[model samples]
Target chain A: MTQQNPQYKKVVEYIMSEIENGSLKEGSRLPSEKELCEMFSLSRQTIRHATGELEKNRVITRVKGSGTYVGDQSRPRRKPRYRSVAVMLTYVNSYIFPPVLQGISNTLNNKGYSVSVSFTNNDIEREKRTLEQILSSDKVDALIAEPSKSALPNPNMNYYRMLEKRGIPVLFINSSYPKLDMPCIRLDDEGIGYEAVKYLISQGHRDIAAVFHCEDLQGIRRYAGFDRALRENGIVLDPEKVIWLDTAGVSDLDPLMDYITKRISTATAVFAYNDEVACQLIRGFNRKGIRVPDDISVIGVDDAEAARTAEPPLTTFPHPKAELGIMAAQKIIEQIENPLMKRDHLFLPEIIVRDSVKNLNKEEK
Target chain B: MTQQNPQYKKVVEYIMSEIENGSLKEGSRLPSEKELCEMFSLSRQTIRHATGELEKNRVITRVKGSGTYVGDQSRPRRKPRYRSVAVMLTYVNSYIFPPVLQGISNTLNNKGYSVSVSFTNNDIEREKRTLEQILSSDKVDALIAEPSKSALPNPNMNYYRMLEKRGIPVLFINSSYPKLDMPCIRLDDEGIGYEAVKYLISQGHRDIAAVFHCEDLQGIRRYAGFDRALRENGIVLDPEKVIWLDTAGVSDLDPLMDYITKRISTATAVFAYNDEVACQLIRGFNRKGIRVPDDISVIGVDDAEAARTAEPPLTTFPHPKAELGIMAAQKIIEQIENPLMKRDHLFLPEIIVRDSVKNLNKEEK
Candidate 1:
């Protein structure tokens, strides 16, 4: 009756009540194992056992890698969900994205779900068009997406509402702009950026410059982290040292190149919002006859492929891209099972020290 | 009536006859626009209009982005397919791969097919497990995979057969070995290597060294190109100048370091199998106090992400990553619709001259 109940038993009781009360209706999906793990404060193994028992008792039906679902025999006969989901993304051929998508596909596929992939390329119009096309088909039972132009308000909230109106479960990844009263799973972009700056400051970097994208949620949030870190450290930010980027032109770091050259003597360290920019910054530095960790230190978020192979390797923050995708998939599946649930997830970034940062503290001593 | 019909009308007749005659049958997909394009020798727009009319008449129902299919109006109505596909790769987060996958997803997605992504990590066991898991689900209607251990015979060919047995279409990307009677989309690995060596020769580099991955198909093929080029130029391959790489430890260029340190003085140029190896080779040369194109000219194949950002911005061959992926997706979709097609695609690599390969002829002049 209280918290004294063993978690697994409580789980069984809670699901039963949901079904009996019609909160969890027949022939609908159940919350993902991950969600149940958190809800019951139990490990996945325990949740699995509880779900397994339910399946055996014919109280629920279990699909591998997919979540448990309410059984027709448990209540009244009803049609099972269409084994289909829509996954919308932006910038498919670049860093962080492919892995995230892979995570989504693997998780969905295991559970016998078919995955439809759509790319908006971060264009709002394209996002709207793609969403409309997918939603109108009504083939997909649920949808998972990365909202385009995530830092700005979305113009396609109506399509999202249509998804809701049609009883399709919806979930977001990366940035969930125009919240649409829906749940999202994203990285702690601001936190990672803040930590990166803090780490640089800890290594005795005072005059640090940064390259960031200005148009997206990740860029804006990371810059906010950078700003917050400097403010807390009593270091005033210099507008001259900030390089604002358009996410679409990420490969063209010419602006970053100019900034690195002009500020070579003054800025002791450079921070990039993502690993690709960091690698570019290093290349730009090399072009100007500046050396990484010697003439200046470099730090970047997202310990992506570019960071690993960049010259001197890069000191970076781990973005946990695949995990975010998995979480997003699970959230959408859970929503499909229960339309009333509202939960958001944010994964934190971790630091990985490579050869990019210069230890000014040791030299000062 | 035999063959004088307008191609679009012919296409319509072809499809309906197949359905009515029980050849194409029920529950099977119709050909893609591209396939229909080839078959009818008509433009895509014409084919689109023909399919559009069919969709409107409800003789065939079109799932957006997925192919059109015949429907049985006399029987109880049922929804169309899952519109799902499985895309398996060796890696997801690295150079050239992300873009390739993006192309596949984008192409398939436009046709309304869902994608299930799987990673093999190039381990045969992992490949088998991933394939089995995908096959067991039977959720995917078609599959596009990059064969792992592509230079060696696949142990998981049986799983591919199972996919065919289940009426699911299969296609390969990058390389196809064990010739599972399925088609593949790949790059001309040998041609690129041959061209790289020839370009280096044109620069008057008589003393050349090469780094290769001897295990994979690309590796062996590229090495063959290297050897053929040397022999054609009346230069015998010195074993000391050949640094064979283990594809698994590609990032750890320690073996390459040893090669550069010991061979840099005698070797005037180095050819790397891919851009990753080229970038690493440059770094190794730098560690040995040798500058790229100053002490040794460098050329590489598969001008990947590493080549673009490397210190010298490597002179390499362009491996059409995205096109290959796109081709594989289209091929699989075609297979699903036809089931009698057996066409393999191999894309040619082109030269991209950057700063890494030094022109010794200029110096001589």
Candidate 2:
């Protein structure tokens, strides 16, 4: 079953060279179909055929959801993999992850590092399993992870310690475990929160409501910042105006928002944890006969794609999504090289003024 | 390290009983932290302690991302596992998948079957890998997959055939490979397409444009139906007015919609593939100063959550999301019990009238 076709043979040779040169490590995933097609200028069929041949030859293995990996699945490779990095994220295709993943993959791929990604769905149990797999696999030299439910007490701390003990450097992205002495690359959530609320306050809105995800460290930090801004302005924080949520609560905000509507009816403005929540709140508000920036003002963090197309566009703060991912990849590689190295970064937020916030002072004047 | 606490002992005993009763099998994942907490009526700390003890004793193994399994990872369990099922999907948390997953899990769990899920991200390479892993695992008694790019010339057909040879019953949901002889539960995409276009025509629309995903079979079939409706109504098809897209193209519709504006300028109505696409097109058209249902009526398939929330609300055909999921689960279980059983269903489409489509006939009169 040997192929005489030059294109097929070329692909096979390219893959073999990639493995031989340590560009594709044993147990590491190969580049995606789109990437392979772009690299070789080959059709999908030729690429699939080449991979099929490679799989039969025991040089590559394909797993359904995780993608294709180097080495054979029939035998587990005990040797430490070369130039391989594993990324554990909440999601790979949704929200702000695409850019972040692209940033991480593009940076690592250019440096000849093989990257394999796993999604935790922001579930602690799933995160624990992912960490255990990476620890036992011996396929990863380093890891970059976004802590799942960072505000909650996570039991996966032991797994992180085990990775550290094994000399496999790990870096946190987006969020980190407060107990773990690990470096993290993330946006300044607290600063973003402060800036969003302060901007809203500058518009002469005294009564403000906030929707926050209590499970995420980012959400908690942002809420803290919101509190600080209100305190500094000599405004008393109304307990009823603040809504604490988790992952599940964010999806169905209608019932909660309806109940919150009456409680926060006196509030003139609402600060959401992120653009997604902000947009949903606006919709939930609209459904209840309340209009944004007219009946009430709204502001949010993370100038995500949703912010631009939102009903009145959203007044938001930049999240530094891709930049954070690139930095995390660079820093993780740095840590892998120098085990003693420690670096943490917090990208400050920049205001992206949109139409969601209303200036009550303008009307008063 | 002995746990003297009765709560911890009781939790441990319950897990042991589950395994003993065959509800939990070797190489199958254990219930999540929330599930355990609910079942035992115990604190998370106690549940963690019991699981820790279980892990230490080799009663279970925890892997990050994938979750905790009921067997040791040090050795591969080659024997066929009991009452375990694996679901392969494009996504678990986004768009229409959550309801589908909930339906499947709820139904399966009620029958004492443990379910594990994997996401393909609609990438063929990832799907291929997922199939290979399931084939090698020997843990899953049955498999349910939402085919990745069902319209594409898939090379993973051999993997499906291999699953069949191994006596593993496979079921498809949402979409299925046309080449594969498998039971699938999905919506009547073609009928929905025809119905949508026909509805627009009934509202006195003659020059209708279409937007569809070329990679998905649903899109292709819908386009076919769209074509049929046009021909039957003595309306000639305009190739320039039809826009075909893939996954990546759907994200940023601005540039494409900008170009398409000129070509589809004469089009009085637009039939979108789904509500997501329909909502984006409405926004795109709105940006281009074209008001939906006023300047041009629009109809979409899938009365998804987006349809109702869309600016003017969307006129769409319904997609039996959760119902399809529930039916797929029941059929898959039937197939697993009787490998020779064959069942395929196509849920009929029903139009949900909304504000997006205008009555052009009234204007003409």
Candidate 3:
């Protein structure tokens, strides 16, 4: 490359210089073979070789039935070259994840970086595959990923390390593996859980039933909050009253329906994992002639659209969906540009009170 | 013009041949400068020159802490090159669109292409900006877009043509513009509408009401079905009973509640545009002391998660959300590989009978 082929290199540089100087723009038609031969004072074969080298280098393309034209390879002068980063999440295209994605995309797009998103469906294997694919990808300058089954040890740590080796920074969103000292934008799920149960206890409801998903770090942390609140309140955490759901998605709600119908007298209130479960619990209770608050008070977390719009307006804690996305994107962009800049962000959940939770001191269930 | 420099050209060709012959692979660590110099029996300066030229050509990258390695551009023999495409929707992180996004991602990923997602939020200005960004992007080889404000004439047709001019294929999903003539995978929304009304009529409900959105092609097309069925049943469509909503997101439902309360005596059955609206109508009816099927029968489209979980599960036509996505991806990939290939796909909506719709002939309001 130091001692270049003089003639073809001259032709390539001439066209490239023209492109660089704004005489040739993207999709602009290049000079025909005869015209190039006249301009460079070279044979048609020489022009053909020059254009062939250009095509090989992806500097131009020969469209079928159309003339040769400039390709997008040559950087546009007026536009900042838009670099792209990716975000890999557990449940994309779900009820809860979209707003977060919206925030991330808005932030990244505004900063001139296109965002690529991948969903792992909360499967460890898919997560491993996705991380590997992303690690090997040259187009991605950085990444924001939510580790799958975060409470358990992951097999994909090597991929993350590989990104580190390649000097491509990765920021975690929501949960992260305990061993990986990664930057993350996370919700204080444990604190939210503690607040939820503490609020119920403060309302004079001593017996609380908790429905939690135990597989991920978020669920485990939230349960820890539940345990802490119950301990501080001088109440025994009932093993029989706890419902553990599968981590991937909605588990069989039949177990919960049965518990709601048969074991209602055991607990005066219920703390659901999120608004979706709370809504389902309400529907289940209504089937057995048990009304919310009037029969069993219920509260949940993640004040999603369903929480606000659902009948009785579920009382829960709001996760910073958009804020999380924005934070994660900003961190990744900051890291991509500076490479040395790194930061961790945490968003604490705020209690959203609605009609679901009843004041036990004022009324009897 | 056709002549090549003997020394650097030989080294470049040697390494390329080694790569092509499976001696070097992607992400494989190349020999160090000292070893390469000794192996080639060349001076350190010559080896440095060759390696620098390789780095300039992106044949290899030199990590600071780590040794030099072959980059993705040199081509791995075992792995196929991963291509990237984009999916642009109005609201990507919404209820209805997530499943479609999922479908697109799953389909494209399976075919070895990475997917980048963008949202325009149904704003024309954002759509124009996003399209311009995508058009100028070299990474996105194809696009699947749901045009914003599709009912009105678009100002972004020239942008779509720009994608065409750059040889990027486009496939529309769910709804499309009338004049675009681009390949699209659409739902038979009008057919679903006709079926919903016909089913209600078959159940001896003639006083049927319809609520639709007028902003996009789907809304208008579905309304056509509603009109056709009402006319076929010999019932005049009531202008007052027909409710139209904005397409961007959920509009305020206060007007709809007013219509439901005031016009309850006029119509016994109402068909909604989708499950979200249908769920809201059911809630409205409940607030007014009206019961499902017993007082009013409601039908909707898109049997989303809300439809299944609503107090009385909503009866509606199922939107082929994932299918449309997969079809669009497949079509885009097909056209990308073979630009001349052009075809349209239509997914017919099927009725999913749930508890929301009542048989009016057997039961009286």
Index of the highest-DockQ prediction: 3
lDDT to native, each model: 0.74, 0.79, 0.74
Taking the tens digit of each residue's C-alpha lDDT, what string does model 2 give over B55-123? 876678889988899877875433234788899998722678888988898898888888999998776
Q: Name the runs in model 3 displaced over 4 angstroms.
A: A1-365, B1-82, B248-250, B263-265
Q: For residues A1-365, could you state the per-residue lDDT of candidate 2 as single tens digits?
A: 11133677677878877876799998999999778888999999989988988886567889999899988877543333588999999872267888888899989998889999999888666787899899888888889998986754465889998998997888998889887888888888888878878898999998999877755778868876887787789776665566655465565566456555765789899998888888888888888889888999889877878889988899988778788778878877767754534567898877988899999999998
Stretches of candidate 2 above 4 Å error?
Answer: A1-81, B1-365
Write down the C-alpha DockQ for each prediction.
Answer: 0.01, 0.01, 0.03
lDDT, model 1, position A174: 79
- Stretch of 10 with least lDDT, candidate 2 chain B: B1-10
What is the TM-score of chain A, computed separately for every candidate? Answer: 0.77, 0.77, 0.74
lDDT of 1 at B200: 89
Candidate 3 pairs with clashing backbones: none
**TM-score (C-alpha) between model 1 and the true structure:** 0.41
Sorted into a CAPRI-style docking class, model 3 comes out as incorrect
A59-78: candidate 3 lDDT, tens digit per residue: 68888787899873444322
B337 Cα displacement, candidate 2 (Å)? 75
- Write model 1 residue lDDT over A1-365, tens digit each, in one string: 01134457667768877876799887799999889999888999999878877776566877667666787344432222788898888873278888899889999888888898888777666787888898768798888888875643344788888888888878888778644667778878888878988999999999998876644667767876787788789787664466554443355565336533564358899888788888888888887788898998999877889899988899998878888778777767666765544567788867999999999999978
lDDT of 1 by residue, B1-365 (tens): 01133557667767766865688866678888899999878999989888876665456777767667776334443232578888888882278788898998999899998888878777666777888888777788778887775643344678888888877878887777644767778777777777888888998898998776643677767766776787789786664466554443355565336534574459889888777878888888777778888888888877787788887889887878888778777777766765544466677766888899888889988
Give the CAPRI rating of model 1: incorrect
